[model samples]
Target: MRLWVCIALLSTVLCASAERPRIVQGMIRAGQFVRDAAGGTRDMYRAYKDMREANYRGADKYFHARGNYDAARRGPGGAWAARVISDARENWQSRVSGRGAEDTRADQEANRWGRSGGDPNRYRPRGLPSKYYTRDDLHLLWLCRSAVAWPGTMRLWVCIALLSTVLCASAERPRIVQGMIRAGQFVRDAAGGTRDMYRAYKDMREANYRGADKYFHARGNYDAARRGPGGAWAARVISDARENWQSRVSGRGAEDTRADQEANRWGRSGGDPNRYRPRGLPSKY
Candidate 1:
């Protein structure tokens, strides 16, 4: 009898928790949640989100290029949404690494971030544009998450922040951005992926080819896409962009340099003007 009663109580408790819905869309109204503790009210997530959005709005303008970036990329924020989920996962691991996947505090934080569109269902309960966040937005989420979660503690989070900085710096290297641009160019040229032509013939067949010819993926898929449909145009564009990109990417400039280029910035030949040396002539020795 006691066991049955206990099970019933547990189910009721879980159902109650599940019932408390969260819909933090635009502005935050901190009155109700800040008060009703038993109602599962907690403004911490809202606080974290607000702080994160403020930072991402600015970062989205600078770090992410317009007209190309997907709204919901993947990983935490996307494949590169490291700034938001890494530290929390790490810190959660640091605090409770050995525990099972069902660990309490870890599950709590996971639920919080997940509700904010962090994982498999990142698009399901979507609130804002995933492209809305740049690399810096990830940092903002990490920082804000840490702040609201820990409030006054700086020691543990400081180390976390530093680690995040290092990882982000490595991942968001200028090279990555440049590389993506080159890849985009490659896709454009090789596939003959003209903006107009793509849109024009897009529905000519009407066999659900909306993004059929569109390409931009990771290594293998991207390369594979380069062989699909308009991949010829993409390849050509990539090839052209690469001609210039290859010069710097290969580090060959440093390996082999001509004397003329270094001397006087190539304004004039080192040969004496009075010597009257021509392109194919020997001057007076």
Candidate 2:
């Protein structure tokens, strides 16, 4: 499925290239040739031969189709065709033979792998795929060739290059914005968790205070009611109550300390505190 999608994308790009200026299209084709040569995927020399033959036929047709002397005189033929073909061949050779920066880097990486007794062919670039080449690179090569093929297209090439650069930058802006959004969400989630934990600690403290107040009031009544034969029993009850109150206070204090420590740990780690929230706990609380 992924392979099919890639093929579809490449096809779409090629179709789009057709709509580009003639010089750009030529550059794209030339770039393709260079890429094929580097990857050893196709017989580029044969492909070039075919391209030359096709161009020759096209030129011949254009010259003979119209019998007008003035049109034939104005048409690019003979010397012009020879120069364009020769320059394109040279460009193709230079690009395919590791003359460009990318090609040079690829060669260096391959050499490193070879020296390490590894399969150099298996080494791929960091960002790009092993066989991947950009349309922009191809377009530049086409532009170079176009300068030789038809010098008049140089100004148009500059315009297209500028426009494409802007478009490429705009295309990349969304990814940068997406990264910012993800970072914002992470910060917001961390803050929310901290707030929730603080609220939980507040509720626990309030509940502990209320229980402590009730126990103290009950102990006071017991102390006042102590009398006669039941004095020992009342004393025992008072002692147990005091012990129970102390235990509760100690337990609550420990729990509060633990909760605070946990919250602090989460805050430092940039973790979501709400992940430890008790079930059935109200969000407002």
Q: Candidate 2: deviation at residue 265, Å?
A: 7.8
Q: Flag regions of model 2 displaced more than 4 Å.
A: 1-174, 209-285
lDDT, candidate 2, residue 209? 42
Q: Please report, as a residue range, the 10-residue window in candidate 2 with the lowest summed lDDT.
A: 63-72
lDDT of each: 0.33, 0.36
Residue-wise C-alpha lDDT for candidate 1, range 76-120, written one tens digit per residue: 123133223334554576567676654434444444443343322
Q: Residue 251 error for model 2, in Å?
A: 14
Q: How close is candidate 2 to the true structure, as a TM-score?
A: 0.18
List all candidate RMSDs to the true structure: 27.4, 30.9
Error of 1 at 43 (Å): 29
lDDT of 2 by residue, 1-285 (tens): 989856744653444310245554565455544443333212223223333444532222111111111111222332233233334544675678655755434433433332232321133223322122122223333443443554566656644543343233221234543344333333333434334433434565554543233222222223222222133233334434544675577665655444444444343333323344344333332
In model 1, how large is the Cα lDDT of residue 245? 69
